[model samples]
Target chain A: MSAMIKVNLDLLLVQRKMTLTELADEVGITLANLSILKRGKARAIRFSTLAAICKALNCEPGDLLELDKEAE
Target chain B: MSVITIMLPALLLYVAVIVWLFVHFKSKIFSVRSGTASTTDNRLTRLVYHFLDFFLMFIILVLLMMPPLLVVMTISQFDNPEWGIDIGVFSNLRIDLNEFAGLVMEPSGIRNPEFSTQAVISIDTYSLFAYYLFALISVIGGVVLLYILLQLRTVFASLLSDMALTPENSGRIRKIGYAVIVWSLVNPFLQYFGGRAVLRDIAFNVPGFQLNPAFEIPIVGLFTGLVIIVLSGVLNEAARIQKDQELTI
Candidate 1:
């Protein structure tokens, strides 16, 4: 089964006009980890991390993450 | 003269250490800390852990050397009358100590000896190997136990940091539990072999001591292993809950 929750970190980063590194520095996370989150490679992301990312990018959780309806 | 001089100080030190530990544990920092991970508690835990690690390392060293030491010491006594064992001393290779104290205290050349009764022990390459085999098996068991302890230490460390419900820790616990169970199952065979190794060779004229090759199965170890494995399922569920908690935004 494919992942139902899709990370829209790239779109949010683009909308904020920010580099992943810059967001990482602002969010107090490593650039490598930010890259993973942006690439949707992370198994799951922490709420605190997502909150920090949302806070840094001046966006809501919905803007950064979206739920793909589960496939039948 | 030498044994008394050396032993007196050593015995005094041993008693002192035991008393100190009793007092230390009875004192405030080691015992009274109740609620959570205080700095003092962490320090105490680390001190205990460091001591355990050091002691285990020392035991491992002794275990590693046991087989060869047993073979050499046992084989050395083949020609020596009274079957005395050598204690390696500084600048001396052959510092022999007899099992019975009367032999050591008395002057050479027996003039009306009190203890004439001899306890004869038969030894061949097979018997020596048997003894070596027992020590080697003990060493192997001890090494495996140490490996399990290392894994346990990791799990315990994670628990201390409040990461007890991680999937990695669950796996480590499961593996340790299984290792313990396996060791328990295998213990009887090792015990049997160890006892059988030297049991037949020893013919006792001395009273109050009996050698028996009784199989010792570790029922407690097996039970403990089972309990841990069963409890790991709860940890697995807790890990899932933690993962869900993490995923919540």
Candidate 2:
């Protein structure tokens, strides 16, 4: 069974009531990158980017990511 | 020397290389091995790359004999043994074999002795044009090789700094693969025609020993071409992955 690293960026963005563009601008990243993270397509997330994202949303790393144990 | 003797080691080498490749990439065949793409270049590495580029250019020049007078000079050496000139550069040169075609090994009349039956061929006279015909066939094959090497030069140039995942590099590699496969497919038939041309109208003085001409397929070249094409696909994937990783942050 293959375990996927799932992204919860969309949930945190919703709870924070922040648009993707607003988060992108505040984090100095592109909306495209946020979109990729939201869609679980990004192969990796850097610590700096993760820290910026956490600061913007006021969430821990666990709040933005999950271990998807379902076989895919 | 017989063709089999010359080819035995080459075939073995090919098998060994294939085995080594499989072993080397056992589980990572699908995954591109990861390492930091260093921007640093030592002087020695740069010098080696430059030297290789020049060597390739020189080889292409050698393959492109405008008048193919090299063939004439080679045949001349055969005619005049006193010349004893070394023909190392043009190792692929084909000499005339028309008039000297009366070659056949007779089965020993008695039980095969420890010493094999001696059937030495001593050529006294032969047609000169036969050499030209064979050499011409070889030259055509060389032309295809020349194209492959030229494309490879472009590849090396492109890969010096940038990776080999560019559209131009992909196109060049595909073209080289096609050219190599074409050369492999056509080489044997060229030999067949060359053999027939030389074998035609040739009289045999020996009673029962007409030497059968042996021709070979370019297995090594064909395999290499296939491998290059496969690697080109891998390179394209690697390029895509690289782009994805860059945007992952």
Candidate 3:
């Protein structure tokens, strides 16, 4: 109840040297939606979308998502 | 008062309410920019909705005119004393038509049978009042029904494209079902009142003219309302699932 998942998509993109727009295009999602996900405002991410993002960024799901146990 | 005088104000009131609703829901109505590109591949379903759109409009026109028409026709009969109103009193009367059939078969025996066998009553002032009352009830009921149909048209127009289950559409469907149920419950009382109004001044002791509340329950309407209510539930569930699926991406 006190835990929440956070997206480290910005960090992953930085490490992968990929632009947000480029990642959005490669993942076949709108830039606005991608920004929402990157800003950690999304309620949940579909596994398929996460997989697509991971594939586009050349990273694992753990590299993009993080568990913030104390954020809540 | 005359039927037209009684009906005109009610008609105007109904129109005002419709206009108010349109103004209130203007944003929602305008926001429906979706085309008729339905998600379903069934051509038959598309055709049915297309037909319904026109049919609903025609029904609205007929409903609007019916009360006035009834009044006019009745007044004509009232004015002409020679052609008295032929009020049919129906019940479980078992008239043996076997003799009439035999007489008709034999041309020589088939003398001009008395067409005045049924009572032809003069339209008195009380009967005219009764007719007006009946027409008023019918008009009000019709206007309410028409209002619901117009609302339904708006709902359908908005969701013309991809009528996939949504919260708005589900709510509309639920409202329609509830409206129908209310109409069904109210209709019996209206029928009883109208029947009483018609029979209030008839001098003859007609069998079915008793001032009793013998209105039959509108079983078909009840069934339709239940079906729509169930459909609304199904639509809501479908909408939830669709949202989840869309999020699943």
List TM-scores for all candidates, in order: 0.54, 0.52, 0.64
Q: Rate the local accuracy (lDDT) of all candidates.
A: 0.65, 0.63, 0.65
Candidate 3, pairs of clashing residues:
none
In candidate 1, list every pair of residues with a backbone clash.
none
Q: For candidate 1, lDDT tens digit of each residue in B82-160?
A: 6533211111012223444554575577563334322222333334445556556767788878878777778767756
In order, the interface RMSDs are: 4.8, 1.4, 3.1
Q: CAPRI band of model 3?
A: acceptable
Model 1 lDDT, residue A21, Cα: 81
Candidate ranking (DockQ, best to worst): 2, 3, 1
Off by over 4 Å in 2: A1-72, B1-48, B63-128
DockQ of each: 0.12, 0.42, 0.24
Higher-TM-score candidate among 1 and 2? 1
User: How big is the RMSD of model 2?
Assistant: 14.4
In terms of docking quality, how is candidate 2 classified? acceptable
Listed for each candidate, the true contacts retained, as a fraction, are 0.14, 0.62, 0.24
Cα RMSD, each candidate:
13.5, 14.4, 9.0
Q: Per-residue lDDT tens digits of candidate 3, residues B88-107?
A: 22111222334366444544
In what order do the candidates fall by lDDT, top score first? 3, 1, 2
Model 1 lDDT at residue B51: 53
